[model samples]
Target: MVQSGLSQPEKVIGSSYNHAKFKLLTPSENSTKTPEICHAETIIVGGGVIGCAIAFELASRGQEVLLVEQSEIASGASCAAAGMLAAESEDFAHPFMAKAAHESRELLHKHKEQISAITGMDIGLRRSGFITPFRSYSDLSKYKDRRNTTSGVQQLWWDRSTVQREALWLNRDTYGAYYRSLESEVLPVSLTRAYARSAEMMGARILEGVQNVRLVVDNHGVRGIKTAKGEVCCKHIIIAAGLQGEQLMHQVGVALPSSPVKGEIMAVRFPIDQAGGRPDRTVYAEDVYIVPKANGEVWIGATSLPGRKDHSVSANSVQRLLGAASYWIPGIKEADFVRAWAGIRPSTPDGLPYIGKYEQIPGLYTAYGHFRNGILLSAITGRWIADLLEGKRAEEIGIEALSPERLNRKGVML
Candidate 1:
């Protein structure tokens, strides 16, 4: 048998490259000899929120984990997401997503202090609540009855007077509005980076620029990954590669039913008091959201453009979001736009994430298909994947709703 794993010498020879756009720290020059084989308890492909979260959980539980990313952490949809944690704002018709979304929020709230302590960064976790204003009385009346999941959940109904009192910058000509206290917001990139930092501190190896080409499954199960460089043998493999899940699945003869749904967003800097109010909450209005961050920057976005795979920001998308946002805020038309970016969300046909193992592949599991909820759901995704890796039942969330087996029944082409 060939001796595998990084030799002692190779560890010393890698060099670090630092540039504004990107950075790479190569294996040391005295890097240990590249072993003919590599081994770990788990190998996570992708460095986005899903993979990083799984890596963090596995490493925390004393499992040797390897997280390979084709690009920098938070470079995928995780980076482009607006970080809204409102299961209510999303389609409530899907009970499974609703439950998972709520549970994920609970998990994020529970782990806030620990995450801050470990990452030395505030996750920009704001429980400031969310307000959805309406210019149409018909729309206002639709939600005026105040319907939600639980009786304990409070939905604040705001008439014109209340909106004015709260400094909700609606033109006096506006109608009424509603506020959901359960909804909150965070800076997605910041939160994701914190997870990556914590995972690295816990002894997880995060290798950027390392693309996983395929999984190497032996007679028993997944042995490791076949990367551009070489094979990495691992006992368990997690496919958290976002929209790339189907391609990876093809390599192993399993059909992962997934597709890419693209969206674009723009970032802007604005003074806190520009809205003529003391800000304490996020504003979700007119199919757009205005999230105030602690750092004096606000993220307003996210126009859903279905079927666009390229990550280029289009003029129409920028104009449309800006127009819609300005219609809600009125003042945003005067604000200076800072930056714009796009990402392709991994979407399932039914809009729910796939978060369990393929029944055919013993050691292979999946945690992708998050779509727009990827950022908000990352915290719990790690724990859920960890449960599967440990052969324990998922407590906070039910996996049967999102089981890989369920997607197979949909008859999607491989």
Candidate 2:
């Protein structure tokens, strides 16, 4: 439910503090009389997968959680994701990041059924293997010898004949592929909705369609937040607002370097009944990835353009994506074009999401800059947030590595 925004500026009752002023547009009657002063143990901003998952995790731990969003949940990068729960395919700068992804995917495996049961929404979580076709033999030759010793991700070598038997449609010039059983697929929107709905079932409150969001800070730390939908008083605040979340963090002077990366993806109608059938599993080629959806449309994507904020899909980008996919799976040339869209992913300079507390500001934390792994990491990110808030930490997840202050030492903080 969306709360009404304020019509004018309202003063917050607190001592001298640093707060940004964004005009609220709520019912003036309510503001002139008494602003809606609700209370919660924690107030989470941004209703994407990360925000919703954090709400669910906190509620599951018996914490009163309130989430506020400027738009509908999952309308950002969360919904735009291709929904590949990938760990091995991603070339991580840190081994712990990969390990964290593996653990997060496991969390999804453990909680998907329970969330679906509570929300009555099929989250579409499946154990679909992922294949990364290698263009040259030297690349396949290396992975053939050993697995990822650091992250413990299993690997296998699939010869060209094996590829044909498994995915007959992929009649390409590629020599072989590196296969990993850990990568899975899910419906991004469905998974995000399931998390949000389950959180509501557990008594968590969600406010959508809010605007002009700004935090109320004091000497102690975050006091509460003012929005177009009145005000909320809380002890803790976690910003998971995706791309737009950077603005809030910047205003707070937390100095976490965050940027945007745009990814354009499309779906095409595949004729499954044709002579050469489609692959049962997802395929990641050199230039593109093909994901089979429940609606018989093979979702092929995407073109990653960093330092971009807009979601406009360029005709040249579409042509490049389609051409690359067709080179691998010739059926794509004949497949009917469906639709295409774009999403701006939140990214950081070092490529690691900021997950821990900012010691400079107590009761302030962040789960932003997750980039493309937001969907895959949402579950574990929530668990980590809960752990951090309760004066706890998970060593295996590398809490310090994801700290918001890690990059500040390099003097990159804004």
Best candidate (score: lDDT): 2
Question: What C-alpha lDDT do the candidate models reach, one value each?
Answer: 0.71, 0.77
Task: Report the alpha-carbon TM-score of model 1 versus the true structure.
Answer: 0.86
**Stretches of model 2 off by over 4 angstroms after superposition:** 1-37, 138-151, 393-397, 412-414
Write candidate 1's Cα lDDT for 1-414 as tens digits. Answer: 111111110111112212132222223333444333266778888888788878877877888887778777767778777788876665553666677777778788765677666656677777878888888788766654544444334577888898877745545555777778788777776676667667777877777777646788866878777776556678888889898877888887767667777877776655555645324567777577777665556667787767878777777877888787777666776666767777778888777787887767788888888988887788788888888877765434467777776756766535
Candidate 2 lDDT over 256-292, as tens digits, reads 7678888888877766566255666788765789887
lDDT of 2 at 241: 86
TM-score of each: 0.86, 0.87
Candidate 2 — worst ten consecutive residues by lDDT sum? 1-10
Clashing pairs in 2: 5-25, 5-26, 5-228, 6-24, 6-25, 6-26, 7-26
The TM-score that candidate 2 achieves is: 0.87
